[model samples]
Target: MWGGSGSGVDYDVMEVYHLPTGAWDQKPTTGTPPPGTWVYSSVAIGKDIYYFGGRGAGDSGYQYQNSLHCLNVDSFKWRELSPSSDYDPMKKGFCGIISVHFDGEHYLVIIGGLGSSSTPKQPNAQYNNSFGDLRCNEIHYYRISSDQWISPVVTGDRPPPINDFTLTPVTNNTAVMFGGETDNGVSNKLYMISFTETSVDILEVPNPGGSVQWPEGRWSHSSVLITTCSGPHLLVVGGDYAYDVWLLDINKRKWKELINLPNNVTRRYWHSLSVWSVTPTTNWIIEFGGLTEYTDTAVIELRYTSDIDWSTSVIPLDQYQDQLRRWILSDWENLGLSKEVQLLRGHLQDRKREFFEEQLQREIKEKEQIQQDRDKEQQQLLQEKATLSQQLDDATTLLEQAEKDKSSLELEYNEKLNAKVAEILEEKTQVEEKKQIITEDYEKLKLKVAHMEEQYLKEKHIIIDDNQNLKSDISEKDKVIAKLTSQVEEQSQNEKQIITDLKEKDLHIAKLVKERQERVLKQPIKETSSIGLQFNYLEEQLQTKNSKQDTPFSRFLILIYLLFISFVLSTNYNSKQFIGKI
Candidate 1:
């Protein structure tokens, strides 16, 4: 067991299971080890094992590796092989690859895997951003000798894009593929791939024919080509979550169930399987680490040990010295067979004939049963054909009668159709006339609406202009009123000035009268009359001026008071009457 992952860890290390010692030892790798070897394909060619694409460790920050690395078993060294052509199969995981030889050159033929949209995809498959994550069905091969990557013009019935499948090579040019995940889901269908000098082909294979149960369709399963004296059988071990085992007799194309390890082996997927042949007859089909239901330490001696996580073991288990290994050795019981049939034979060359004879009888019986089924199918088909022929004959007669009826109907239809056409034409003419009249009416309405809108606009403008003119007239009347009020205020101020002058004049007249009287007393009584006359003239002049100033000023004051009746009284008033009231 080399590189695979399950439970919780990806096994980038190697472990050696010694048949003689019946123990497992963690084989310390010397050179550059794979960064992330999760679900990668590592095929042994000669002494070197070539590891190819698979998922990287999420915690370690690795990406799906597209680089090819080789680990030499003898040197325990790793060397990375760089391909010349940098093309499709962009960093991918869960890919299937097998080493094949063509014309003396060793090549690695690869198939489907899961990748992102950045990776190259088969042009035939439809993809959308909704499921930008893609799976590959394109044929990619690396020429090992030349260190070159090549994509051959693939022809034939190619399988749909898939991931996590097994490709157990059956021949130099052909490899049998079992279950994998496709767009449709996990599949159990089988396919055969044929590799040539310049191209690859795929052909879908029918599942093994038998009354016995077939293995459940699953992905990330393990399958190995277990060759026997009877024939070559594909030993398919635990897959996904099932611990059920099955064998496919390649020659017979039949499936046979092995004893299930539901109680013993932890059901797993993403695991590894290898065969340890101790002798020509003694063999061990060793299964290694994978996903299981529990944090199971490797089972041994039927002891339940959970002290360590053995999921990382290539052949999973955990025990002393951090040794991750759990070797489940059940010899013939594991094989679900006896020592003779299990190939753990002891000088029993005679049993080979017995096994072969038993196989021969089974084959003969299967063939006879298949032949009977074929005969039955043929009989059904013949019966169906005869029934179909009778139906066709009846249909032909009905068709002939229908054709006669069709001719008569066509003739009658033509007469009716002509009359209908004439009536339609007359109706069409009437409709046209009506349409024309309606169109004319519509035009008239449109014009009338436009004219009404125009008149409304004109009236609106006229009203606005007249309202503005009225406002202007009101402004002019207000200006006139202000001018008149200003004039009345000036007149009132003039009246106040004239009244002040009259008071001063009266004081001066009184002073003159007093002086004249003093002079008369000094000059005797004879000049008294003359002085009095003068004083009287002075009084009359003063009286006449006072009368002119006092003519109806009170009435004018009343008019001013009436005009200011609605206004608040101002403090500037000097009139005696107004002041006294205040």
Candidate 2:
């Protein structure tokens, strides 16, 4: 229904069939578009029809095109989509690329296709040879919002390498992939793939029971999904040069053969089928051109539904008037015209007439001016020509002498030129010899550089190993230093406890001496003297014990301080060395 060729030539114009008038209307298009092509992929989403990847106009063989184009169905205008940065322009073009829309019609999933390494002159030649290598298994999707192609990571079982398959949407997120022809042979296996924003899931469906007969392996078939009173089912029409119709109940996953197709129906492949939902419960499939049992043609629906009950049509006379009004408004905006266009046009006409009159008058004046100038120039030229003639006579005499001198000069120049050429040749040879020597030296230098690079890599690895060993040693040392620091802190705490105990003992002793003095004052004089001597002796003993404890503690402090200083100095020295190496 979109684009096809006839009689070994492709058409560029778009035409629509008017059911009311029962005639074809060749719609005018805007913007440049490629020539007509078959086996290209086209999908309708809203008011835009997206076209991608088709063969060029060649009857025997064709060149592939890897371009994306879109047509506004409402405006009947064609515009090429700029290839996104993610798309490779140099990739070979292909046909029979399967695509499906998901994510609320924001993405188009492009699946397997047939491509070649180089453009061949004949399609038969491509299939006969190099078909295996030409098949594509990569999956890419076009994001409508951002207008970019994304190659998604697909998981689960992958479909076989095949092209020219039918992909019919079963639900919002899923599509039923039917038979496709491959290099191996035609495929009868059915598979389903679920699409998401980031990935795709593919699973092959097992055939139903033996009671239900299945369609044979085929490709280039047409399948359309239509909803009936019971449920939605898939209708698969002729494929691989056979006129057979099959109905598939998607929910039951079973196939039922459709009966009573017209007897004169011509089997076709590589054709297109489109559905027209006329009412809430009725739909019709419109089939288009492909290779029939005989040849290819720009054919429309060969078979028609006789009893298509169309209670109302989507297109009407009022709709056409609305479209006309919109088109007029759009054309006015595009041409930068306004209500003042008519007024401006009239003003231009007046200005043009005035300009012609002015031009005529100016030309008349110019003619008079030219005549006077010509007369003046003729008189001057006559006078100058007479003077030039006399000069010519004088120059003729010298000219003879000049000619004689020219011959002698030319001979001398030739000799000089030959000598110069010889000198140049000798210089060229010497320079070439010098260049050879320099090249030899450069080669030697290159070898030396390579050797040096190898040596440097070995040295670098050695240095890395040494650095790792140093780090391990440093780690171990750090652990030891932490243990020693903790021990020092514990010892300092023990010393503080000892000093506190000593102070308490001194307070107790002083209290006991005071009590003895009070008791002696109350007793006899002899008793007082004895008590005093005992107290003095006890004081001296206590002082000796204090000095003994202080001496040992002070020496221990000095030793600990020296050890701490040595540990800090060693740690600093090692840290500096490590940092320098790094």
Candidate 3:
């Protein structure tokens, strides 16, 4: 259920009742939602539920809206749709809305409603009660695909200007409308409404044959269309000051009263009924809240079955876990650690995986440090090798210089020169061996460094992927936890309307009692004829004034005074004395 007024809830709340779990969960919404409304016309087409024209308390005060809003159940987001053209639908509440498909295009058709127009073109709308309205025969439609409002040709005797009626669609081209409050009062009659490509026909269904008992006139009653083994049947429930269940067979055009209900479905009005299960053998329908007798009476169901060996149990889509999660995502915030010890065992394995990841990250850092140290050692070894080569070049140049001066000092130091050259040649061989060993060590260090770098890069990539996965897990959990964190967009209905309605009911009851007493006293007078006539005339004047201006206990003093005067005149059998006292 979407937006409604109730005790404690003020704003529009998207509440989901899980049948399997038997829990009511409020789904948080996004975007601007329509103000909390009652008597609004809403029709679900595919996944989107469209809410149109309802009376609500806005920033500007109590207003009857002509605004259109859409809610996508999947996303729990609301969108206020702006009319494409300057001309929009009428500002109304208690209107009838149904989706009609023509040429594969969907349109929202709004029938008769009770409200006023900005221009008030119609001097009097429907029974002259709802003045400044031009909406009796007016049929407004919205092109769902194009976001545009268009007018269609409407025909037939549209059910006399009505509101708060129940419209149940039985076929693609038709629907059945039940009781509604009209300028003529509550209607118990049914109107078979048919739709064409560009026009609608609303004609009354002839009274059921055989003088069967008719469902009493009512408005704001609940009805749903269900298919039984025999065919489709329309079952209607309680209405204002009513507690009766009535059923209609479509093919036969007959009415059947379902009496002796297992549970007492007390008198209620403005309630709602939705078909819970539809099968050839049996059908179950669920009834919801409305103005009831008292707090104790609530939540009734109507079940009708054929039971001809054709029965199957079907699970609703909401019973599935994944989709239900989306509907109740707000439930994750409050978690009770009722089984702390038991839950710790379940998370032990996960903690081990977390430890392994940490160890891998540390190993990668150590490998990186080793790589830096190896690079420095390799550079030092290369510098030492260059120094060794330079020393060998100096030794070779000294030997060549000695060869050039050999003739001059041939015999003088022959033994000494030979010994020194042999020593220098041995030294060169040792230096070459050292250089070869140094080159081999540098090659080993280079291969080790390359291996460490490759391992580090591979480990680093794995950590990056792990980090991304963790981020994703956090994000998904955040969405689940964000359900009721904020409801700044939520708004509620004002209490003034409820107060006014209650006062109206109280005042009507008072009027009924007053008129009943008057009828009893308005009889032919015997001896006190003149006083009785004067009393009746005075009473009529009071009634006229009260009708024009109904005030709370405004006539208390007047009623007491009138009663005293009537008593005096009735007691005094002599007319002359009564006139003198007056």
lDDT of each residue in 19-62, candidate 1, tens digit only: 43346666657666665467667788899888887666655565
Badly placed stretches (over 4 Å) of model 1 are 1-13, 57-62, 83-86, 122-132, 207-213, 279-282, 294-582
> Which residue pairs in model 3 clash with each other?
10-492, 11-491, 11-492
RMSD of each: 25.3, 28.1, 51.8
Per-residue CA lDDT of candidate 2, range 110-168, in tens? 66666555532221122333343466555777777787867677887677556788877
Each candidate's lDDT (Cα)?
Answer: 0.66, 0.64, 0.68
Error (Å) of candidate 1 at residue 26 is: 3.0
| Model 3 clashing-pair count | 3
Could you tell which candidate, 1 or 2, scores higher by lDDT? 1
CA lDDT for candidate 2: 0.64
**Which digits, one per residue and each the tens of the lDDT, describe model 3 over residues 1-582?**
877657676354587775433346788888887753777888888899998877778678766777888999999889988521225666777788888877788888887777655523222224234665444545677888888876666666667778878888787678888888777788888888888767777788767546776788888888888785587778888887567888888777778777755333546677766664422334545566777744332333334434222222322334433322322222222234336534553464465467568768967997998999899989988998899899889989988888877865786588788899999999999999999999999999999999999999999999999999999999998886675343322322334554675578567546744764565467534535444565677678667767765665546645665665656444434556656655
lDDT of 3: 0.68
Evaluated at residue 228, the lDDT of candidate 3 is 59
State TM-scores per candidate: 0.48, 0.46, 0.50
Cα displacement (angstroms), candidate 1, residue 60, comes to 9.9
In candidate 1, the residue pairs with backbone N, CA or C atoms under 3 Å apart (3 or more residues apart, or in different chains) clash, namely 288-315, 289-316, 317-325
